[model samples]
Target: MSLIGKEIGEFKVQSFVNNEFKEVTKEGVLGKWAVFFFYPADFTFVCPTELEDLADKYEDFKKIGCEIYSVSCDTHFVHKAWHDVSKTIKKIQYPMLADPTGTLARDFDVMIEENGLAERGSFIINPEGKIVAYEVIAGNVGRNADELFRRVQASQFVAEHGDEVCPAKWKPGAETLKPSLNLVGLL
Candidate 1:
């Protein structure tokens, strides 16, 4: 039941962006890549740092045609309130999704029932709405936005060059392995 390689464009979600509520779903992600990040809640310690990091890298993500959405179980009102109070949150230009029902978090399989919050999960979905990559970390750990950027670049490279596959620690302009019988055991 792993969501890997599965398409998730069918699920509709409400996201708070720039102090407004809007619908973001498969259709909204039709023409660009998406980074769907799930944090536990608003006004939390580690969450704010992670979110601020993502905000700092927002322009870079946008340059790659990716839309970022940070989701939590809190309502849009709560998100707005936090944005108003926190200078770190006020710098965020991307959408903050309200998953009060936990439906979206459940769909992404990041919801924790005991704590009633989401795990630190991140999904990199392609423009076609297929989930290309995903990572779920423990609640206490913060995610690396730079690594997320690298992953997106690698995925895009692989998609564009169908015959090549990126190796570990592959960055843009790095060598990619071609899948062939002759290449087996060559490395």
Candidate 2:
């Protein structure tokens, strides 16, 4: 089933951020835009590259009132350990959510049962805790943070405008299409 417009269930997990362990919960995630970025595992190839890319754009996401949470089935301790050892992971300022129990992985429908890991999934959630946009791809493929950032911008724009839709390669301040009966024939 599609997770779009579906409200997220209650969850509370330990997160590694700012050289410390913190608690993140559904209540904390509510009332703001959030991105739940699920990866296969920590201390692996491709994952760090993607995470480092996001780290570079973390401030941009925050400027637009969105928070990014990178999740893996690994424990919070593992997250911290990796952060300490890897320069790429050390650059990350966003929260690294530990889903060791697979609660979050299952909730996001990205869990790999046999492997006890998550697939590559990116979810954009609105202030109301409902998913607005999501993409789940093969584990071997890496995602683009810039594209994800653009998507978040598009999602926010559509949410506020309601009547207008973003066109291909749409950016903020670019023209948006307002659906109407007059345009039905064009499609």
Candidate 3:
């Protein structure tokens, strides 16, 4: 089943952010753009590199009214511990959501049932709490924050301009395709 256009279910989880622990809920994520970035685990190879890359672009995401939430099945304490020991994790200013119970992982359909771990998933949610775009990649593969940012930009543009569709490699101020009414019968 596709999660696109699907509204997220209710969830409340603890997060480690800015040297403190706070609660984040589905309600809190509403009324704004959000990115839920799921990884296999913390303190593992490739995860930090991807996370650090996101950290580098955190401000850009924020500037565009988007919030980044990095999620793992690890506990908040584990998140804080890793942040303390690793300089790469320390660079992260966004929330590190703890999905110890797998509520979030299961909700997003990224859960690995046998291992109690999540795959590498990136979800872009709109202000209405519905998923607008998402991608799930192999555990060994890392994703690009720049591409994710571009996707968010595209999604936002398409939402606002319902008649136009973004083209390949679409960026702000780039041309968008407006489907012609006469083309419907050609297909």
TM-score for each model: 0.93, 0.96, 0.97
lDDT score at residue 173, model 2, on the 0-100 scale: 93
Could you give candidate 2's per-residue lDDT for residues 70-93 as a string of tens digits?
A: 999999999999999998999999
lDDT of 3 by residue, 1-187 (tens): 8999999999999999999999999999999999999999999999999999999999999999999999999999999999999989999999999999999999999999999999999999999999999999999999999999999999999999988889889999999988898973553
1-187: candidate 1 lDDT, tens digit per residue = 6787887736677777887878877687777899999999999999999999999999999998998999999988899899999999999999998888888888888989998899999999998888989999998999999999999999999889977889999998889989897775564
* TM-score, cand. 3 vs. native: 0.97
- When superposed on Cα atoms, how far off is each prediction in RMSD? 2.2, 1.8, 1.6
Looking at model 3, the pairs that clash are none
Stronger candidate by lDDT (1 vs 3): 3
| Residue runs of model 1 more than 4 Å from their true location after superposition | 182-187
Query: 1 or 3, which is superior by TM-score?
Result: 3
Question: All candidates' lDDT scores?
Answer: 0.90, 0.96, 0.96
Q: Which segments of model 3 are wrong by more than 4 Å? A: 182-187
Flag regions of model 2 displaced more than 4 Å: 182-187
